[model samples]
Target: MISVTEAKQIIRANIRALPSSLVNLADAGNSVLAENIYAAVDIPAFDQSNVDGYAIRFSEKDITLDIDGEITAGSEIIKSLSKKKAIRIFTGAPAPEGADTIVMQENTAAANNTLTINDPALSKGMNLRPRGTDIRKDELALEEGTLLTPAAIGYLAAVGSAKVNIYRPPALTLIITGNELAQPGLPLRTGQVYDSGSFALKSALQLHGIRSPEILHCQDDPHELTLALRHALSESDMVILTGGVSVGEYDFVSQAAENCGVTKLFHRVKQRPGKPLYFGMKDDKPIFGLPGNPSSILTCMYVYVSLALNMYLHKKESLYQPAILKNAYRKTAGLTHFMKGMYNAGYVEILTGQESYRMSSFAKSNCLVILPETETEFKPGYQTQVHLL
Candidate 1:
């Protein structure tokens, strides 16, 4: 078995980034940019008022002025400010020519066309939003490969881009395999249990912005599993199968994938609950066979599948952050273990159960306690790596 890092590197190297598509800015949230976004025009476009005030030329003393015209948002004032004069301007109005400063209405006393500058101790350009203050024409406002966040969307809109080039979302499929599994709300036989892994995996994928994954449930029949694998490979860019990866007699997912012309990348990793994890590729489509247990399925998804997707999309890989161990965490030294835990304020507390089948502890976990293979035991206050969920 190879280490988790080695397996991840293999998966990352094999996956290819999806193609780009032109999408509206409103729909580009959480998508990766495919091209450099250049500013079409200067932000603010023109010198405008930053405050609702009188546009005036700053003078040495308090000067009496006549209001020539009024300018509000979206209105044009062709008049200019002359000496000892001002224009009534609202916020976002273009600054009239010859006006060098804006004295807020609170600082000026006005009656009809006459106005008195109560205090003219302001400097020029005091409240003018200069053209290109936020962005300049032809400037690269956003770089290629950037993950578009809400702020990026607003920025793109401000720069007058109605549409942006972003990477297309990958097509995904999920295959759940097990003979002892049944759907929720259905009566279970004497030894059968409800299939919780599929639901959990589906929910996790949804949280990561993946919806509408084609799901296939195959019992412990090799022919049925092979057929499901073939169908998934034909339609999806990536396929994730949960269960039937271990060495048991009934375990046949790996075999089925191989029979369907999938090239196995690796079958096991030096990890605790997810040791039997499998990664493969068939006709350029990535495939993963995750451990059947609920906790194992979710853990492998977060660590392996999520990383592969991010890498394939050309986004930055999420790394395990360093944190201090809140309490002494002990473990064996051979295998690299990803333990469910809660992290806060620079510390992480490992959850009680590390078993693969345990779902209760996994439900309460908000982070993973990363135990390196070299560390046998950890004392309180010891620093460790943590992967936040």
Candidate 2:
């Protein structure tokens, strides 16, 4: 068994990033950029009106002017304003040639073919979006390693980028190993339990921009589990096995993985709920054999698994957020405890249930409070570390 820090270090040292791929903007969801993006063309492309009103030369604002034909958004034609004239224009319509300002329709009165400027406070360039004002052509838009958020994707689209280069997330396969597990919504036989790890693991993977990883289920038989491991290694860049990693007589994940030619990096970690976690590698691919308990699998995913995935994308993030303890807590010595807890702005309170099989408190908690193995006594107002869910 190894400490949590050592487990993380070993996992990181064994994995490497997958190659970057050019993906369509539509498919890029909160992914990290592999390359710097530059604006392909000026935003707005032309001076355009931001309001529904009139486009006019600023010098002509003080006098009544004749209204020319209107300009609507997406129109291919541009009209030039004659001296002492204004053109009716709507939002997103290009400013007519020889025009420098837009007057809001709400601020002016118009009748017949002429217009009258209303109350003051109008200035030059008012309501007019200048060409290239948002981003000039060929300017750096987003740097490499930036997260492709919704706004970032929209901004890239504005600059005419249909696709981008992003460090690829792995193709993952999940191998569920158990004979006593029954699918949800089905009648359970005696000594059987409903499987929760599959749903929890899939949802957590989705949060990292990974969707719909292939799932394979097998019984505890040695041959069947080995075949599952072999198939997962063949089809996926990473494999996660839930259940059957412990020393139980029925547990066969470790043996099956070894039979499938997977080199074991470590078999246990010195943490609560997930102590029997197994990590291994085959060639360049990484494999994780997580404890069967619902809470343990999720916690291991957040800590050990996240480190490996981020390393595969050339990304780094802090693992803990500091908070002040709201209540004193005590625990047995010799094992580090990752207790489910509630975290607010700057404070945290450990909840009641911390058992591996119980998820009631896990459901209510937003973080995993870290209690060191050496420190057994915690007092209120003491500084603590938490991993936010």
Candidate 3:
């Protein structure tokens, strides 16, 4: 059996980032940039006013003069502010020629179209927004590989980019295998349980910004599993299967995938609850056979599948962090273990009853306490790795 780290490396090596496409700025949120975005023109474009005030030359202080003209946004002023004269300007309006300062209307007394400055503390460049002060022409405003947040989208729009090059989201498929499973809302007969792993896995994917996976549920029949595998391989970039992966009589997913041209990379790992995990590839598409147990499925998804998908999308793959255990944890470690735990207030506490099928512990857990392959028990204050859910 392979270690968890080894399994992760193998899984990541098979995936690749999606190709780039041109998308509108409004639709580029949360997507990764594929190209560096340079400013097409200087921000602010020209000298403008930052406040609704009177534009004046710095040399003019005591002279009462006529207002040359009024300048609003998107309009130009043909007249220049001569010595001892001012121009009435609004916010965002271009500063009149030869004007280097603006006295806010609140600081001046005006009557009968005549204005008198009440404050003499105004300095040159006051309330005047210089051209390219916020951003310069030809400057690289957004770098490649930047994740486009809402702020980023607004920035791109400000820089006059209507469309941006972004990496496309990968197409994903979910295949659930098990004959004893029944859909929710159906009356369960004896020896049958409602299939919850499919919904759980799908919802988890949705939380990570993936919402359009092709989901397929197949019974524990070889023919049905083979057919589903074939369909998934052709259309999906990644296929995640739950159940029928363990070494049981009905475990035919692995064999079916291989028969349908999948090259099995690893079929099991040295971990608790998820030891029967499998990963493979078919026609360059990655496939994951997660453990049937609900908790194990979730753990594997967060640890292995999430990393794989990020690597495929050319994103940073370091989401898990090492944390100090708040209390001691007992284990005879040969295989790596990932136990459900709660991380809070700078401490982590492992939940009890980590059995593969029993998901009660996972309900109260928010993290997975990762234990490396070692033969030792951890005491309080011991540092261990944790994968945040």
Model 1: clashing residue pairs?
Answer: none
Deviation from native of the Cα of residue 246 in model 3, angstroms: 0.6
Error of 1 at 378 (Å): 2.5
* Candidate 1 accuracy as lDDT: 0.87
CA RMSD, predictions in order: 2.2, 1.2, 2.7
Give stretches of model 3 more than 4 Å off.
61-70, 74-83, 118-121, 182-192, 358-364
- lDDT score for residue 240 of model 2: 96
Rank candidates by TM-score, best first.
2, 1, 3
| TM-score of structure candidate 3 | 0.89
- TM-score of every model versus the real structure: 0.92, 0.97, 0.89
Order of candidates by lDDT, top first? 2, 1, 3
lDDT at position 304, candidate 1: 93
lDDT of 1 at 383: 87
Question: 1-389 in candidate 2: lDDT tens per residue?
Answer: 88888888898789988999999999987789999999999998999999999998888888998998899999889889899998999999998999999999988888899999984999999999999999999999999999888999999999989999999889999999888889999999999999988888899888777898999999988899999889989999999999999999999999998899999999988889799999999999999999999999989998888888887776675358999999999988877889899999999999998888887898899999999987889999989999988
* TM-score, structure 2 vs. true: 0.97
Evaluate residue 200 in candidate 3 and report its C-alpha lDDT on the 0 to 100 scale. Answer: 82
State which candidate, 1 or 3, has the greater lDDT: 1
lDDT of 2 at 292: 95
